[model samples]
Target: MIALCTPSVWAQIKNSEHPITGYAPVNGLKMYYEIHGAGKPLILLHGSHATAATTFGGILPELKKHYKVIAVEMQGHGHTADINRPISCSAMAEDVSAFIKFLKLEKVDILGYSMGSGVALNLAVRHPDQVGKMVLLSPVYKATGIQPAYWPMLPQITPEVFKGSPVKLAYDSVAPNPKNWPVLVDKLKTLYSQNFDWDQKKIGAIKSPVMVIVGDADMVKPEHAVELFRLFGGGQFGDLQGLPNSELAVLPSTGHVGLLFRTDWLLAMIQPFLNKQTN
Candidate 1:
């Protein structure tokens, strides 16, 4: 299932309404989203550094096969309203949860990538009934298998200080909130330096069906995917350890950003996963 999705490659979302749709979503930002198909609602959350447009690209088309996909771009990214305040995983998660409820959706299949996965976790944990099924792709280190609430507070940095990091330079080129600049850079660095311990006790609280996917080379690493997959099904050291019905998909030679453009393989696997649920 490992295939190349070059940057030049593109996918046109046919049947998409003009300019997509925007709503006065939670967090007081105009969240951007587009709806397609005519079935169970599936919420797609993009990575922090990317917009929904760039992350899903081609997969949205195929997902429409059996799902009414609602791909949403979070605040400070893509077509969503911009904000200058500090950004945190909990802040974004609250915004996402509010949007889902504001829309009056009975339940939704949720898929989150990278930083967005943190938001998804918060949603599933706090509003478990709203989530029918969940998928986390290379979730941030803390959100995947750590105690999301136990995140260690760190010193926030400015973009100038973040510029010293190589990863920051590569991220700033298409930065969604250029206004936040150094604030964002410093925040990400701090977030990465210390991973919240999402232990089995915390994960045991999640009762929804879950699937964890990862590119073998993902920045979060394969071991993380295994831990998440195990947690979703109950971990070896936990009460529900060895719980069934969870799966982990590993795509070799793929990383965080690379997986975003690699829609072919993503659709091939994700389509079947969601299909099994709705059917």
Candidate 2:
């Protein structure tokens, strides 16, 4: 049985406790993934500059009890080595799509955080039939979805800034080439610095049920989440018009880092949504 742990224990769990781990050859990169428990497939995608263990380690134990949790490390992050290509959310989403097809999973639930949430959104929009239910943590579809103040700092991000942080520590422990840390940072800097945004019409056309969760103080503005909710046909008077296929949740007084630790509250809300049938 996997015991619940904090992100600090990521290296320990990733090294010794992974139940099933393998590499999938997709999009010219050997993507690494870990599988735990048994039930309907639920894919877990980590944020940028993080590994699956760091992003979802706290809730993996609880989630594994109910679903076959498949945690994946995307391009240039964690165990997956970077290719000689630029990093983009759209391309990463396609890599995940190819990974799903590689596994022969017809449909699966997906939960993504931060950068991973953008990949999840791209997957849903690009391959709607392959996704069942989706949960986006601190998601942002457009460049403007993020707070304006954070923009000025994006291009200035460097590997040296996170020298002793958990993100850097986690990467050094598990990444194939720790020396490539600077390269990874550069790729991510370029990816986020772009003025890229998804088309609204495509977002509104997704058929899969969605759950949007955000911290009240998250980098992603609460108003942006509500706007995304409306695109999914939300913002209705639920008392009179019934609930929408999608949900929007704002955690009180939470920040991006602290949002993942509230596993108790997260599972309480997530279980029902994943189990509920959507029309």
Q: TM-score winner among the candidates?
A: 2
Clashing pairs in 1: 145-198, 146-197, 146-198, 147-197, 147-198, 158-182, 159-182
User: All models: lDDT?
Assistant: 0.65, 0.87
* Cα deviation of 92, candidate 1, in Å: 1.0
The digit string of per-residue lDDT tens for model 2 on 80-187 reads 999999988899999999999999999999999988989999999999889998999999888888888788888778878887677787788889999999999888
Off by over 4 Å in 1: 1-11, 14-20, 141-187, 190-195, 234-243, 277-279
Deviation in Å, model 1, residue 4 alpha carbon: 10
The prediction achieving the highest lDDT against the true structure is: 2
Over 44-149, each residue of candidate 1 has an lDDT whose tens digit, in order, gives 8877545565566557667767788888877666456457665666677788788888788888889888777777887877778788888778774454443333
Colliding pairs, model 2? none
Local distance difference test, candidate 2 = 0.87
- TM value for model 1: 0.76
- The 10-residue segment of model 2 with minimum total lDDT is 1-10
